[model samples]
Target: MHIVLSGYYGFENVGDEAILLSIITALRKAKPEVEITVLSNNPASTAKTYGVQAVNRWKLKEVSAVLKQADGLISGGGSLLQDQTGMKSIPYYCGIIRIAKFHKKPVFVYAQGMGPIHKSMSQFITKNTLNKVEQITIRDEASKQLLVDIGVNKSMTVVPDPVIGLDASAFRSEWLERQAFESGYISVSVRDWPSEVNFKQKIVESLDLLARSGHNIVFIPMHDEHDEKASFELANMMSEKSLVAPGNLSIEEKITVIGQSDLLIGMRLHSLIFSAIQATPFIAISYDPKIDAFATIANQPNIGHVEKDDWNGEQLFDKAVDMLAERSSIEQALREQVMTLQSDAQNTALMAIDTFK
Candidate 1:
């Protein structure tokens, strides 16, 4: 069967890229002969990276032509339906689903994370478009609740994010050797967001404190272009020596790096996801609700809200110190949670693919 997969693909965001990889891997496992096509921002690179037929996501004529021949379109495993990022998000994703429907193709809304859609128009578009899809699976309860609030009463199953199902055994790295500068390290992942100007400085100050306490700090840029600048800037501000990982690391490499860390303090959702998959204990900095939700579900502490003025260096330092002291127990708890999530994530794919049969 042929399936057209759509989302924020080819964006070089490691989290979204990991989701794409996980979905394709799961689908292939279910149906070995399945043909997968991706709608991506960078078609050529995506084609190379995922070894799938990729078309420009923005090119309507090209996308419509592909959808005409596909069995179904799988919408997402990320926050594609949310307007918190921008007004265009909901319309863009819904447009793709509508086009697939127009071509008489089945569209599965796969493992989506729904709104912070505050606008009436976006809500109307989401409810109407989602109601037409053949099947829907969301990653969290909040998403399902949002759908219900928006009047999309269709049966929607809650599944873990696809990244939770990624097999970490395939990738392994020696933390000390790879980093070369630190014997033991904490993995820090950061992204640029519209926050107070001192946020970055505070993060650096916190990491510096950790460094003084004898933990080497490593900055991981999950999105190469967007995050690399933040990672480097934070690294530069630290009084203690730190390293910013190279931007070109593959998903596996990134996961391995995260797995090897002693602990992770992350702003990116996927950074926390990767930490969980690898059984690395993490402390989340809540830049978004998704971060808070994942932290709550995984039963980890969210140090503070990124948007709130109360998040400061001292609070972060205290949290890091507390989590570090309880590392062993924390890792065990994360592993147990991840095991359950992995099973659910796998079942979600099987259920979605079963519709094709």
Candidate 2:
């Protein structure tokens, strides 16, 4: 069987690539003979980076041909269904679903995170496309509820974030070598959220305490080049004595670096997800429902919601300090959930492939 997987790919977003990799790996394990093609922005680079065939996102003629020749299309496990980024994002994705259906190929909305959708036309398009899809597997209960609220049905099943299922065992032991850098440091990851939250103050307070206590400070940027730049800006804003991680690292290196943290404060969903899966202590900053939902699901109940204007650095730091004592227990629980999510996600993909067969 041939599978066409779609999402915000070829953008160098670690979370996006990680989800694609996870789904592809799951499919391979369940069906080794499967032929896979990824729809990406820079098809050549994506093909080169992932070692998979790629077609341009807008090349529907080519995509339709692939859909005609393939088993099913997988519209992935990321937040691609939202209109917050662009008006075209939802229509563009749902258009693929509609085209796949037009060619008599099944479409599986696999492990996707649903919206904060505000567009009526996008909603109409999504409802139409979702109603006809062969399967819909969402990563969190919050996304599932969002779909239900938008009039989609029980056709959806809960799958954990695919990143949790990634094979990071290769770098597990490397954390031992770099543990010294994080001995007394607090690590923070910044993302484009909670502009309403007092995040700047939170970072300042946390780092100030760590600095006063003679501890190291680390900042992790999960999104773009500007992330670390923002970190540096925050560092300077606070006191200019902060240790900012240079944004010169690759995704694997970023994960490795995060593993070296004593306590991680983050707004990036996958950063926190990876930390939990790897037995790292993390305090999550919630700017969206998914973050809060994941925190509740992980039972780490102390997630700080950054008010767009409040940016409470002290509260975040205090939470980070509190999390240090519970790392072992939190890690154990998170691991259990991670395994369950991985197993369920694998089974869902396998079952979807079986329908194609």
Candidate 3:
């Protein structure tokens, strides 16, 4: 079976990369002899890293050719159907699904997180395109609800995010010794997002407070290039004992680093997801509804928007301290939830490929 996978691949976004990694893992487990092809922005790197045939996602001719030859196309496990990022997002992803359908190929909308699609045209495109899929499995209830709101009344199951099922035991990093990470080390992952002007400064204040309380701070950039600048800027603003991790760490390396941390204070969804997979307690700094949704699903506290007008550094610090106090119980709950999510993620892949069988 030749399956073409599509999404924000090759963007160097750690979260999306992790989702691809997990999806590939699950697909292979279900059908070891299946042939895989990826539509990616950076085809060469993605092909090399994932050991699959990759084609440029933007090249219409190449995409059509792949759709013609592939047995099926798997759309996504991320926020691909949303227009909140831009108007192009909805059309671009749905366009691929439309092409696959044109080729009469079975297209599975796999574990997708649906939108904040506010525009009427985007909603129409989403509902019409998605209704033609062979199967659809959403990653969250919010996504399913969004689909309904958009008038996509097709049956779709709610599954866990693919990364939740990734096996962390396969990757190891010597980051603890290399960075001299200490006993009470807190892993902080931040990203650049449109927010209140003083967001970075407030985050710096919270980290400073955490450091003063005797916790070592380790700044992790999940996407080396995308996240590095913001992480370094925040690190520079802090007077605390802190180390900014190298930006080029692999997905496994990032996971290992989060696993080794005493706690995770993160804005990236995957940063929090990795913490859960490792059974590490975390406090989410919400910048998107996806973050809050993940926190609610995992039963963790989301300390509100990181850049809200009334953003309070003291409130964030207090939440972190309170979460740390109950770390043991939190970790236990996270582990139990991860086990269930892992199973759900695996089922997502199995269901996607069932059409081939």
Error of 2 at 296 (Å): 1.6
- Please write out the lDDT profile of model 2 over residues 1-357, one tens digit for every residue: 889998999887777877888888888888887888999988998888767889998888998898889888999878989987689889899989888999988888888889878888877778878999888888788888888888886488887777777766665334325545535666778765436555666667777876776667777777667677778777776763666665645556667667666667777787777676666777777777778877776666545666654446666656666777777776677678777766776787776687677
**lDDT for 279 (candidate 1):** 90
TM per candidate: 0.96, 0.91, 0.97
At residue 199, give the lDDT of candidate 3.
75
Clashes of each: 0, 15, 0
Please provide, for model 1 over 1-357, each residue's C-alpha lDDT reduced to its tens digit, 9 standing for 90 to 100: 899999999888899999999999888877888999999999999999888999999999999999999888999989999889789998999999999999988888888888799999999999999889889999889889989998997899988999999889879655435557536689999998887646788788899999999898888889997899989988878889888888778888889888888899999999999999989988898878889889888888888876787778878988999888899998898889899999888887788787766
Question: Order the candidates by TM-score, highest first — what do you get?
Answer: 3, 1, 2
List the global CA lDDT of all models. 0.88, 0.76, 0.89
lDDT of 3 by residue, 215-273 (tens): 98889998877788989889988888688888888899999989888889899999999
